[model samples]
Target chain A: MALKVIDTIYIEEEIKEHPRTIDISSKFKDARVLTIGKFGELFNKKSQSFRLQKRNPALILAKKAGRCVLPAPKGFGIGGHKNYYFSHMYNCLYDCSYCFLQGLYASADYVVFVNYEDFLEEIIEKSEENPSSVKTFFSGYDCDSLAFDKITGFAQYFLPRLRKIENCEFELRTKSINIEVLKSMEPIKNCIIAFSLSPDEVAKTLDKKAPNIKRRLDAMKNLTDQGWNVGLRFDPLIYSEDWDIMYSKLFDKCFEIIDNNMIHSVSFGPLRFPKAMYKKIKIDSPREKLFIGPFEMNNGTVAYKNDLEKQMSDFCQDQLSRKIGKEKIFHCVSDVV
Target chain B: MEYSYSIRFVVALEAEAEPIIEDYGLKRIHEINLFKVYRNNLANYWLIVSGIGSINAATASIFLYQYSNANKSSFWFNIGIAGYFTGPAGEIFLVDKILDEVTCQTHFPRSALTKKIKRDELLTVSKPREPLSTSHLIDMEGFSFFDVVNRFAVRELITVLKVVSDFPSYGYTKITKNIARNLISNILPDLREFVAEAEEISHKELIRLRNPASYNEVISKTEFTQTQSKILEKLVRDWEEVFPERYLIKEIDGLKKSSEILRKLSSDLNNFRIDWL
Candidate 1:
């Protein structure tokens, strides 16, 4: 089994004398050289025809400033209205079995677009279109916002611009220990640093290269100490044997570093995946026991039986509500907000 | 001298690769990833079952190349289990070439590749988990060796060999993990000689890569935390300034943004309490 790095060709016109792209070459030292084909051809290749292209992942760096189609940030919420989300990078450095990006993309290599100015311009224009005054932009939907904090300076370039906008808010959702990025920058009131958590046992088995829950919590503590807004996300909650204790302890840990008054919002959801996508992932790694179970299919999605899902969600909601008020807790689901 | 080489066996899985080294009395030069390297008296070598994916293979190849760096000439026989396209559960293959099948890039060159091995037109997919396909042979790490050794111009350095354990139809389930574990243990001696012969090379133009001096300047210019600064301090000390200064700087910038984004998102949500009905 080789490093299986396909190939990456340089595109000079995209970014001018960018230093970050040069750094990517060194991280993958001695990686083989492959053709640099067009963007649509390389990233969107799922069929067998383009297999010969040797699609080595590339890191693109550009400036993104503003845009159109800015989701109404205040009136609508994430399962409720237009929430504008953007991915500066596609694919992650870590390989997790349940990740959707694996089935969604053709190549395993990561392609980072080095354009930050362009993204900013679009966000600025969209935010101005609505007079609601409060616009929220979501990062980490396609990729973990902080996982590669060492590779791309996303938060650094985007945060200053967001702070200048009167009714704009930004979310940095991640499972990374690299919070030092925040400590060095100017503290803006409109930003919320969200941490994704699971039980230690579950993370050890599934999170792959992600920093353990403890490390992430510690990072959150450091950020909160510096007067930053923090939130907890227990997403895609994988069911384990000792359900009650696993979640209770996870909550206890979060409330330790976070001020009860400063906690922004908390959300939880059950483990689920698209049926066809799940099947493809199962074929990619057949030995994974997590996928081979009595999963219930609900609304073209697979999850625990309805009763089990209700039980897990209810238990988490009830117990978590005791520590923090019910008002700060929200369940992120497509069906209801 | 024109050399005639035949690939004797290709055993997949690190567990299987280890016992074979013991059974064949091969010289254990390096233990990288999962595979333990062994060689014969003639200097013929075998890179035994290393591990289960491209990352494992690449790491093992780097270790192997470093171990053999001082030798006169060293060749490798990438012998292990692989998934195949043809029939017969136990058919043997001389995989003259290793392809990334997905990227379709032959990252390595033909001269550096194991010879007399047929270019079976098969693919080696790397998985961090278990092999989900019903292909020919499924081992953890192989293509990485094909990739690294070639770029290093050490291709004149090896051979590729594989043995089919389960046909494509069996769904890779029939071969129990235990049965598949012992495949390499059964074929150690033959693989060692094939590698020993390929290690021969005459020294003429040994290409050495050049270093850029700008790295040191970046390190000195950027501001880093005590912990961040400490990491940079150690890295610079160990490798005489080829360390990635720019990567460290960008990391510093990223950490700054992450904290800023979180702070902004949180404060915006504060004081907004909507009771669920």
Candidate 2:
């Protein structure tokens, strides 16, 4: 998808002089720049519509204060004893129907924390705190890691710093094909550039403004061919009458271009959400057909029925195991009843 | 005659409202005495004259909203004349930010309209004021107009548009009723285009809020508790999404209980196979 033009930029008074802020603002010379005391003053304000703001969203540059790194939720890692995640950005460029960011944030504008050193410092401190264990730090929890890289220069700055850290694995989860910076440099063995995947039909229908599945698959192939460790993520597996056939074809297409040995790991997660979040997203997007699917409240969480969940998980696990080892395939089952 | 409008305009004076009223061919509604209200016979637009100042603008907007029975999906616009720091007295601007001089509060109106029109920050003062060190467009009703209308509608559907009437070189006393009318008259074409876009957005929102025709038919034929009514509403929406070609009313025609009707609808939706191809 073509990048939407940035017509307005809100700068926090604290970060107005920051180098990153200046660099980003200089690119959009014509965009109107407004000063504010804090990003939350505008981003967290009520009466803002996520749907409407998605049409013409502004960029808010701010200095991230307080704790920059937090422990990852349980069952959200790739076999690491200590897992953590950091968000240098809030909100995504793509408007996926099932994205949790829409319900988590009231405004659809992008918030880029200009202070990247603080996040890196905390990651190093945490990794050094437990030097013996393989601590994994996940990026792109709240936003796509590389989708805004052209403007944010996220990977170009963070990859070099993260490469020097000892016994730390970094994961950049994305559905973007913005890989020019990644292709220019040597692949970091410790970093895994994970791409979120869905069936072509499903991605086309649900992942609005995101790169098509074909483009994503091609990016992964190119990165893996250049010796970059890439991972496959089939998350929030959308269910339909012919889901099995569609997913089977998807796996065949993925394995056709990407070598099995180059694949770092494969993870599949069932479509699920906290009950309150599901309710909010449903209200925000009342016409979205994905919300009207076969989902039920299970122990304060909304997910597919037990039988349906099992059928999907078992089918995906069985299909993926045929090509990759069982040890490399992880089932991301949340702590829901 | 009762007419439903999706776009409501709140102007501070009749001179500012006349150009729009004439351009849209709006007829005055005699029943609404609290505010001077005009609406087109096509039932898509309304304009109200709130006699000058922030409080009057707020109260008149509320009055027009209730009197017109506007829905949450409707668009609200505050259009009038304002003083700018350096203006030729005919420039139009879409207010992106409103700073209230008295309250020291600021509001950011979501501007989803096209960027072809120039945008400016507005300062809503308590009374008439001259240009200050800042380059903000000065007005008397923008802040309160946004502050109140936002409570009734989403910020995206709310806008504040201003046409510069006086600036540093031209004093406020030089402005007259005819000048204000002409200033607005000159921009009627652009204003009409902007309203058309807003109307299209409101129309889509209305469609999203509307349920399938079968929902009303089923509700009229059956007896349901309040909770059952909500559940049946969701079930029918799901039925429409899953099986648009199928007729839901015929399947639940003879079903008396809400439970039976809901079950039939749910079963039909569940059993239907969705072809992704």
Candidate 3:
């Protein structure tokens, strides 16, 4: 069995005495604890190896002093006129080779902003500015929402608060199967429980330490059957020799247990990364075969060639469209919003 | 059969390596002044004795590393006698943290090391003292040892092991070369356990990087971008890992362009099971 032992905990001096820090401290009683003036003091520093640090990473609890909520990139969150994202955490527990987070930070240590109320405050303010227009808040852009839920208990503390804002929507995107917290509480309708999926073959090669495809599908089924609005995210799709057949089988397996009415939305996109991120990931994971596949640079992004990208997206959309309503599907593009 | 030595030890004194050198049956191979190298061909081991002080430790570590042409899996360790304010002599501890008194900079060695031995922090000072300033173990060369070795080796593969030599009860004056050698000789078994584990880790890495030179000509012939260069390295490594008996060089000889070489390699690798090994 695995143990919940963070190699170290670098607490921010400002919030060293905060109750959330105390609660996080209680989770790993035996972790080696240290105090830092700020999380960025060590986190943003260079020359640290992300791949090596992932083997034994520390947890950093700090306060986000500025910009608690920022607008998400174009076409990120589906079914919203205005979409903003807030990250209580940076970095992730799973070591997916395709994950962009590996290149975004020099260190693999988890820097969790313990100031939840501040994010909620900004969220409430934004949602109230236009009471009639619905806005969505996307989590898991940098870290999996549920993978670290066991440690962060982010949902436990913030799920109830999310219910307070009638116009705001939440999307807990993840590849984790640890949904015990959601299973315990009554399903939140405004919050969409999105599960990122890839074919089992693609996942086996790329998604290190992430829950297997079968388990994630089961978790999605359990949530959707309980009346929770679920979303299927096939973004950054991997191309393979039998990709069409593989994705078809995957859609069949997912729809087998998931009710058509419960799936609030479905989205798919090609595997793409900003050039800088691709450059960093190439160095970080030099031996990973995923980086070895053929890719071309297009408008500062490194991804599959244009024809292949269209083929992959078209095939995946065609597969999902056969079993689901057309209105439920969305292609995540830069101008989609 | 000839054994390839992967684990290396750099000590401050010959007496520090005395028991280790003798017990491991290491024969002296290279020497210059007080700096000496020992090897046991059968066990694939290397031990170097670099005099004293941080400068000497740094120099000798680099010397042995270059002389031996060590790889990433090679383990570089600095083992010596240290004095703590309270610990009794012959007490073994792994240094998890090092504070350089002269530089006032701290270095934390990777803490993922085995817990078979007790762990402690060490403070490297310029000169010996009558009383300790902090509770950390005081040594003469740990911080410097890590500073230089870490540049060329994996942090997890480098470490500092210290056996307590003296405390307030028994000052440094009472300690001699023979006493230092004796204290080290007593903990030989525990030290062996550490080396064995480190050697085990190095052996696993050996399987991946083994004979990477087989595709050197093909890789050198191509002009790949920085990112493509890295991806090409993985493709070649994966091919070598999965089909070590097959030759990638012969297959690449007919390919004219870089794209052809990469496309051919990637096409072959796409069929591989990532966890085949």
Candidate 4:
């Protein structure tokens, strides 16, 4: 899906004159520009409904003050020993029904941290601190890495700088088909363009305002065909009556065009959320039918029943084992679980 | 059970409220002396004429909310006149940013209606001021009206609309009660259109809050704890969403205890297979 036109923008007082902010502000000339002391003054305010704000979200441009990079949550990475994630942006352009951002954030406005240099500086420092091991730096945990690239210029600014970090591997996870910036640049060996995918039926029903599975698959093929290593993420495997057939067809379609050798890693996991977050999401989208599935609370986490989860996981694992090696496949469990 | 959609308009003057009350055919309720309240019982439209200042607007809004029995889904609108730095006088604007001159705090009201109406920034001062050279639209109650109503409802459900009554060129002295009435009267069609769009949005929320027909049937037949009642309400809602063609009451007719009814409903929903196609 293409990015929609933004109608409003809130700029932080400190970053009002920042070059990146000015560059972004230039793109949306017709949008109403409002100044504020901090992004949180509006973004974190109470009584702001994420559901309502999602309809017409504003963009907040601010500066990331400190700790631009942090360690990734447990059970959240591919295979790197040291996995860290950085968020230069908060909130995604797409509004998937199962997205945790709806619950994690009070408002649905997009917050772009214009301080790209601070994040790069911290990433380089962390990578240098762990020179002996391959530290995987994951982007798009809190937001899509490339979905808002045209507005934020995140990939254009960060990719070349990250390419120089030899000891670190950077993963840009996204469901977006916006890859023109990546296509223009020379392929970096350490950068893996990971595309999150689900069955066509599941995605059509649950992934609102996102690119369809076909478009994502085509983007993946286009990227990998250009010698860029790609990662396949079937995480949050949705469960339905025909889930087996649906996922099998999805896997077959993915492997048909792209060779298994071009894949850097493949990860899949059951749909799950922390108990508190699950409740929040349920409250946020009370009429959503997806929450009516066979889920149970275990160890303070809400997910498919243990037996059902095991059955689905094993079936996918067995299916994936036929195409990819076991070493390259990872099972992502919820950190709370 | 049926859920009615509601919208409350908080105008600062009786003259400002006159056109809206007449347009919606609202009758004045005699009980409330704190503020002048008017309502259309059949349409669920309400209006309160708050006197003047920031405190009066906030207090009158709360009073109307309680007196009218407004719910979380109800839309609250602070609509009235304001003075803009440069205005031809009948131009109306939906407020996007509200700056309180006393506290210097800013508030942003979230509304999809901005796309339908022209928007501007509003400065809520402690008292009326001479038109400044700045671009802010001046008002006396916008900030407090927004701050207080926001606590009771989501930002999207709360809005502040201002019509230019006076400007630097046409000062405040020329504006009389008749002019105020005429300004609002001339813009009644646009105001009605805005309220209609707001009501359309509020109707969707009301549907979300509406209970299934079987909910009242089941609750009337059995006694349940407050916690169990909430659970049953959710189950009933899920049942209606998933199996709208089927009657939940028919499935739980013989169940006496709330626990039994809850278990039965859960088991049926869990066992039901959903076809994505």
Candidate 5:
């Protein structure tokens, strides 16, 4: 309860119009109250008037309206193909060095748009719009889906909606130790709770503010016990001095709590970034070692040397295929133009 | 006048808060040094669980207060399981007062605006200990729990409720490893409803601060003189001269913009607000 908070304050107006505003706050029991205003809702406009001022710590509030929902990005699917993604919240709580948010956002403040119904409504409408028999809507794309469970009540509100959507499958991606949102309700059959995993050493060194491997595994065990369709994402695999040994052990540790059959799918990709994003992140925090990794600009993207990427992907593919049948594994390619 | 209901809950990590996270449905939305964002719901009420400790509890509470959007009748209840001195296992108690044992300061939630519930004495300490500190319950997160809720001017909206599962008290091992799924499921719904009602009443009692009017009224204020305001305004203008958002945007806009790249990126950055930190 004694969080070393930098500051606290309040905001008023505009945020009231959000559909999911009902669930955006539950996490900070006692946070420093900062300024609360209604005018900061438009992301683009807010950016034009932005200034980086250091405050102890404050939660900013802004109300948003219209276009409350979006289709999942293309090429963002898993398993049987159809995929769409959406995020209710932007940015995240942790400040990991390699996080895209650092380069993506100009401010470190946390903003939770109090709107959930609109997201659900959009999902329901979009699913109806697609007319496809098999379709999936992905959450947690812009932020960890469950990381703010206590704040947004995402699962509490969305799970019931998904249960109603006969052809819609929902995926929640996260690296958090929090899973009570899922445990509170019956695990939805079409819903897949995907976990992002990294080796212990990598997590310890680069993951920064995330929960350690043991805690994450413990959460996985509980989720599986609850009969949730679990997924493993070993994405943007970091190459360190002892990657092979570290990955082997990580795989073994993973198999301990997760049955390969219960897992919906396993996917991975190499560390790749849009070249401009890499440059922006470097400018934001030049000391980040990740920018200096054996990388090259291929097309507009920065990625590991082709040979290294091939070696890593090939090795992971082989090891994962041996453990889980080939059909259950997918390699997210970075060279997609 | 009635306001919307907001149930606020605070949980302490005797060992670590991770084990109980699943039970709370908290996903680490984001992580900061002292706190991480977690959101969940039990029935109609939304519950926000913070990181381990009092500062986090306070910070999370303030965040919830601003974020709640609760009207006059909104209720704020701090719902979570806690330790007790002599309470029966599975017994629930509504804390009448949260005493910060470290500071020897006391925070009492206004009982008038809340529905009368089973009341008890609860002492929050900096650290969790055995044999119960001779105070009723022992916890680490409650003091900040009282502090933050009090700031929103909704003290009555705030209530501390706990399910006693341990004694002497709930050993850290048992509390951390065991309390999940089953335990939380049983207690949360009823608590959620109770919090909703309480926050609504508390909201009615909150005194809204009046907005200041014209320059004449502003000048009538005692603390600052017209000269001071001018000086402060001049200082801010001087500072803006050195660092202007427009200038920065222009200088870096072309080199960084390139097909609206910086603009999009800056939008994301500028859209970043610290309201819900």
Candidate 6:
């Protein structure tokens, strides 16, 4: 439903004269321009509606002030103590039904911070805190790593600069199949290109506006063939009739073209939502079948009933065990702090 | 359950609606209350010329929606002339923000369709008052149009396109029926594209919701209350989406009576895991 039409751009007055802002404004010559004091005034305001704004979202370009890199959430990283995450942009191009982003923010518009260098500088500072040892930082937690690469050029600009800081590892977590920028350049050993996946049925029905599963797996095969470290993320495992065999075939298809040795890590997460977020999403989309299900409130979070949750988690775990070793498999749950 | 209509244009003035009606080749199909309703079913476009003020705009929109039995897929747009604090007499704007002077309430209109036009906030006032804000535009019926239409549909499908008629530089006397009609005519080509895009979205949305007569029969047999009926409608549609091949009678071998039907249907669908997915 949406094209690259950010006709009305709200640029922070401070960043109006910045090089990145100038470069972006040059791209949308026909877009109406407006100035604001800071992005928070527009982004964090309470009166905005996310569902309505998503239809025709405007672009908000601003400078990143204060801290750029913060520690990642406890259960967010994979086997790393000094895990950190930075959002050069907030919000993703793809619209997944189970994405936490929908409930996390009041607006759906993409907030592209024009200050990438500052985020890198802070990452460099954080990495130096424990120099000579390896630390991990993840991008695309707040936004997709490469979905908007054609427009944002995120990996194209960051991958080369990240190579300079050799001590730290970076993970570009995304569901996007756009690997042209990554294919153009040599693969970095420390950077693991993770692809988020779901079964074909789920991806086709639930992952609206996202690349097809076949195309995504094909892209992963291409990337892995180029000797890049590829990670598979089956996060937020959606439950439907015959989901076990669906995910089984999905995994079988993945391992068909993707080499097992080249696989860096594979993780799966259960479908869940916060209590308030569930309410908000329910109210916003009353016809959403996914939300209107037999969900139980567990510790202020709304999720599938305990038995169904166990069945889904255990089934996925059992399927992965048959094809891959346990060392590389991780299940992300909130209690792992 | 049967609506497949397109853009519903709500204008406060007859002159502002005339050029649009002429350009779109709209025919005076019927009348709702005292408001003249123009329709172009081939293009799936509808127009209602609300007389004046927020009450009229709100009343006209409510009337049009009720008269046609429209659904959420139908888009409602308020196209009219407004006075701006600055800018030329013919400048056009998409009302991204609207404020009601009396209620002190604000509404923001969002659109996904791309067009080559500028956007700004507008204020709805009681009288022809001077503009207090430098960047915002002043109007008589924008906030009510936005407020009422949003109640009928999602905010994204509701739009407001205003023409600059009486700016500070241009005197109020310069405003005329001919000028208002001309200003709306100037933007018809772009508005046509915008309306077409909205229609495409409505078509897609309606496809997901369009159910077969048999499903409706089963839903009605459940004898759900008014509130329950709406909820059941969503549930049935969602079930159809995921398990398109599953049939009620074929799956459940021996189901009789309404209560048993509801129990068996919900039990089997809910308890069973969709492994194919």
The sequence of per-residue lDDT tens digits that candidate 3 reaches over residues B141-228 is 8999998888887566787999999898889888899999999998898888888777776675454345355555776886877777
Off by over 4 Å in 5: A1-12, A17-57, A61-66, A334-337, B1-277
lDDT of 3: 0.80
Under CAPRI classification, how is model 2 graded? medium
Per-chain TM-score of chain A in candidate 1 equals 0.84
lDDT of 6 by residue, B62-128 (tens): 9888875677678778899888887677788888777899998766566655665778889999877
Instruction: Mark the regions of model 2 whose C-alpha exceeds 4 Å error after superposition.
Output: A335-337, B1-5
The TM-scores of chain A alone, one per candidate, are: 0.84, 0.98, 0.96, 0.98, 0.86, 0.94
How close is every model to the real structure, measured as TM-score? 0.53, 0.97, 0.86, 0.97, 0.51, 0.75
Residue A196 C-alpha lDDT in model 4: 93
- Candidate 2 vs 4: which has more DockQ: 4
lDDT of 3 by residue, A306-337 (tens): 88789888887788889898888888865211
Model 3's DockQ?
A: 0.22
Most accurate candidate by DockQ = 4
Better of 2 and 3 by lDDT: 2
Docking quality category of candidate 6 according to DockQ thresholds = acceptable
lDDT of 2 by residue, B1-277 (tens): 3222399999998999999999889999998677889988876688899998989988998888888778877898899888998978899999988999999999888856674778889999998977665689999999999999888898999988999889888878888999999999998888988888888878777776766658889988778889988888888887888777788887777898878998888887667665655
B1-277 per-residue lDDT for model 5 (tens digits) = 2223334445544223343455446555454334444454432233455656787788776665556444433445555566777645666677655678889866544333233345666777776565365647666777678776555533434567766766764464576435633455566565546645655444333322111112223223334445655433322222223233533333333442132432333343323221100
Q: Single out the weakest 10-residue window by summed lDDT for candidate 1 chain A.
A: A47-56
Q: Mark the regions of model 3 whose C-alpha exceeds 4 Å error after superposition.
A: A1-4, A36-48, A128-133, A279-287, A333-337, B1-5, B42-44, B130-134, B204-213, B217-235, B238-246, B249-277
lDDT of 1 at A260: 79
* Model 4 C-alpha lDDT versus the unseen true structure: 0.88
How high is the CA lDDT of each candidate model? 0.56, 0.88, 0.80, 0.88, 0.59, 0.78
